[model samples]
Target: MRGGPPQAEQPDDGEGQAVLGTGPSSLYAHIVNKDDIDGLLIGRLCAQIVLPEPDPDAWQDQIRDVCAQLRDQYLKYPGVFRAALAMMPTNLDTLRVNEGLLAILLSGGIAPRTAAWAIDTLSLYVGAYALERSLLVQRQRREGDDWVLSRDDLVGRFEALPSDRFPQIRQHAGELTAGSGHDRFDFALGLIIGNLAHA
Candidate 1:
């Protein structure tokens, strides 16, 4: 699947947005199983599978029927347990290396368990992604202010962090939050897609 630049975005992707109008990253949120194909496609590459390629009308009808049923459940009982696959976050570095990797994995006929395991391994990205988004939102809000990040500002006044108990935190303070937002994400994604080899 590793080929070229990432393709088109899903038109309806903006719907799965968080309550705070925050965007969900490429991270999967457990709604990709049999009953929720449409849900999986929200921010993930699964959306580009092109289900309607054959009989566009039929494809649209089927997709709509599925989405409608899902939407109905939400209206009838908000926050109900809807079925989904809940894939683990896979190595994204490979994806950035080759956008087509997503399509390959989707069609590869790999065991679902293995797929899930791989996804789980990439789960580390979720936290970094969330933090980056929060930072961006705050930065946008305080855009005009001359925000100088000094060491004092960096090390927020701690009230007994128990460094003796958690030595790693005390030792690698900067490494914990070293890179720029983009750099951090890129680094995490590098691990995600890092193991790809041309077939």
Candidate 2:
């Protein structure tokens, strides 16, 4: 009964009943199935996001702000983004967020097709990032130690590789693994959004 991601293939009716303190009949009365529950949860999460008014002069910053907000919200629920992956943006709140992001991109003079694809790309990245973070936390908790490779350990491993066989990895191990907090996240988003200027 781990509360990580929702199991799309097999809905846990027992867990749902336990959480609601009701039997299957009682629980199913309000919700049709697990997919319905997932949709509702995702919708509620999306509803919490505060989309900023589009500013043509600062569309990039606005996009970053919205993405950061989404990352924060996704991290709050630890793996809830799995449900988002299982479905399209049929929920009103989810659609609202999508529309807001599209508006921001369009306000910056991005092409309509580019703006649409950007929204998909951003959403995918944010969800995948949060999902990975959640899984790492869960693994750490289960193992009773940090589950990720330490920077020093990673660097050492890279450095130990034969120079002829792995010249680049041995020479630039530190740079390869460099980043703390959300630095990589910011860098990746910057690459994506920065390219939109030409689009």
Candidate 3:
């Protein structure tokens, strides 16, 4: 998972050979094809996530911990989440993680349907966040060619927009570009999980 160009850029067979330290024939002997590899890789990643026991009183914190664990795992490999985007969670380990999250949500008093949807939403957000972060890291690593703008740069751009058309953006540019690290991630998770009691 750690070696290679981002997952988006690496060829499946090539990755398999490199990872397995074998030729294509040997790789095929163990797995059916690229899709199988994708499933297995994602399954392994899901298996690494630490799930908390269901606790009604601490459901919010439990949910946050689960999501943070997922985010940390995705961030480690820098683009491995792309596999998660392309496939459904058919792997046992992936389903285990989902079940664990659903249990926590349901314990919090969320309706069954709402809890299911919340899991979907949280998974989507985590995957997208990880993919975006991976791309940003890659761009920043390019020699003398960083594409991700600094918070100040983004704020300046927002403030430079036509004043009449973007009055709010100009006025609140600093706030708009305020967060560092995973602050925005935590705030977004709070918005999603904090409302579960009333959901």
- What is the Cα-based lDDT of residue 69 in candidate 3? 93
Model 2 TM-score relative to the real fold? 0.84
Clashing pairs in 2: none
Per-residue lDDT of 1-199 in model 3, one digit per residue for the tens? 4333223433343643443356655555676556666677778778898898999999999999999999998787665678788778898999999999999988888999999999999999999999988888888888887557888888889999999899999999998888889999999999988876677
**CA shift at 120, candidate 1, in angstroms?**
6.9
lDDT of 2: 0.81
Give the alpha-carbon lDDT of every model: 0.37, 0.81, 0.81
Across residues 1-199, which tens digit of lDDT does each residue of candidate 1 receive?
Answer: 1233323332232433331143434422433332232333322332222332223224223333323333333222222112112323233422331233222333444344544444444332443344445455556579575463544455542212577786766666666656653566456545544432221
Model 3 C-alpha lDDT versus the unseen true structure: 0.81
CA shift of 4, model 1, Å: 42
Q: Which stretches of candidate 3 lie over 4 Å from their true place?
A: 1-25, 144-146
TM-score of 3: 0.85
- Residue 135 shift from truth in candidate 2, angstroms: 1.4
Model 1 misplacement above 4 A: 1-163, 195-199
